[model samples]
Target: MANKIILTGGGSAGHVTVNIALLPELTKRGWNMVYIGSEDGIERELMTPYTNVPYYAIKTGKLRRYFDWKNFKDPFKVITGAYQAYDIIRKEKPQVVFSKGGFVSVPVVIGAWLNRTPIIIHESDVTPGLANRIAIPFATKVCTTFEETSAHVPSQKVEYIGAVIREELLQGSAIKGRNTLFFTRSKPTLLVMGGSLGSKRLNEVIRDSLPLLLQEFHIIHICGKGQVDETLTHQAYRQFEYVTDELPDFLATADLIISRAGSNAIFEFLTLQKPMILIPLPTSSSRGDQIVNAASFQKNGYAEVIPDEQVTKDRLVQTVHQVYEQRSIYMGNMQKVKKRDPLLAIIQLIEKTALSDRSRNKKEK
Candidate 1:
């Protein structure tokens, strides 16, 4: 029988991209892959094209740091999710399991542990997420995007393999991207993204500053699903609800990025050597991972960050212009500080861990 592996992660595209990046390589290595995620989560939609990989959905509860009514109801959901995951793992009998830390992954990691399956979890931020924090004790290895993350995780199990950039993303063409949207070809393009779910505040500020921005830069706004404004359709500004195949092209056309400081997305920008003005989620609303990620990039001269509270039309426009003016500096810094892509190293680790697990299992048998 062929070697099998179960992949788990959901809630955000970030939680799944590493696994996605590894898929082609995994297939090349002759491993059959299965995915376990929430029934209606973004992972299901994102993974739809890989029809060969069967997807299993388990009931998942949100793991929130703040108080909410769902907190009481969600633990039971997590327990059920674990039971479902256990059943799946038992039947699948995979050599190893990989989890990209999200609430949905916690149960899968626990289930894999119960089944004595080796688990590898990837953490994309300098600070470990809540789900990964809970899942770490059960993981055989934890792959991290940032070297600084070692301080937050157990040094023994953590490895500093950098962010996985998808192969397709690198194949984007600037000419193709320019042709996709008819615009002032000579003007520089600014790409704006508010994450998978979209950011209301980020959207509002950008829309408010559009007039001033459009004069200097063509705007391509990925306004998240259902966040598009039907009322406004300016020639200088184009808004997309969401994009898949055309994403690389859109990214290719961008001279500057305006984005939330999510580690996975920002790292992609860094790898592309794109100058950016990052707006991080406020600590009051999030665990503030973005704040740390953004600060690190800014301190290294790769990007400039503007706090949410400080965002206004004048500041936003001025900041964008400032970042654009310093584009060469950011690109140079990005090139200077660039780390080797960790995809190959991570695949080797996965194979090694799986081989060892299989050997141990055979001995026990």
Candidate 2:
């Protein structure tokens, strides 16, 4: 039988991208992968393009840090998800479980733990998210993008694998990107993106500052799904709901970028040597993880962090100019970062986990 593995994580593109990065390596080693995620999440939409990967959806509930009526009801959903996951685990009997730390993965991790499967989780933030924090004890190994993140988790369980960047992203073409979008100018390309869901704040500021921005750069704004404003039809500005296959070229064409401080996104930018201005999610809405991520980038001169209070039309315009002016300094710093091939290391860890299972099985026989 092929070495089988269960990969679980969803709710956002970040959770799915890490798994996508590992899929090629896993397939090369002849591992059959099953994905367990929420029934109607972005994961399903994202994974739909993969014909070989069988997907299974189960019940899932969020674990909120704050009070809500759903708090009581969600636990039952979690229990239901756990039971569903347990059944899937029993049937799949995967050699190991690798979770990417979303709400849906909690039950899958629990189910895998119940089945005596080794669990590995990769966390992309400097601090563990709520789901990963809850899933930690069950995990045999915890992979992190930042070394500082390991300080919060069990030291023995941690390994710093850096970020898992998709190989396709490394192959983006500036010329192809510009030509595809009909960018005919000598001006720089400014790429603006919020997270996968899109950021209302970032969108508003970018749209507000566009009159000043478009004068200097050929702008490509991935203004989130449904967040596109049809009223702004400037020839120099292009807005996309999102790009799947064309993102690499689009990224390659970018001279400067504006984005949220998601670990995977920023790391990809750093790897590409793009000077960026990161507007992290406000702490009131999150655990302040993005702030920590943006701060680290600033500390290392990889990117500039724009404070929430400073996120306005004027400020956005000023910051964009500043980043454009100081682009070389930021690029120089990003170039200094020692890049690691997380896909290889993660695949090795995943394969190692499966190999041990075979050893134990043989010994038992």
TM-scores for all candidates?
0.98, 0.98
Which lDDT tens digits does candidate 1 get at residues 1-365?
77899999999988888889989999998999999999999999889999989999999999998889999999999999999999999999999999998999988998999999999999999899999999999989999998899998887899898988988888998889888888657799999999988888999999999889988999999988789999878887899887778988888899999999999899889888899999999998899999999999899998999999999999999999999998999999999975686899888988999889878988999
Worst 10 residues of 2 by lDDT: 333-342
Local accuracy of candidate 2 as per-residue lDDT tens digits, 268-341: 99889999999999888888989999999999998888987679888888888998999999888887888688
RMSD of 1: 1.0
Q: Which pairs of residues clash in candidate 1, taking residues 3 or more apart in a chain or in different chains?
A: none
Residue pairs with colliding backbones in model 2 are none
lDDT, candidate 2, residue 296? 96
Residue 74 local lDDT, model 1:
99
lDDT of 1 at 253: 90
Worst 10 residues of 1 by lDDT: 177-186
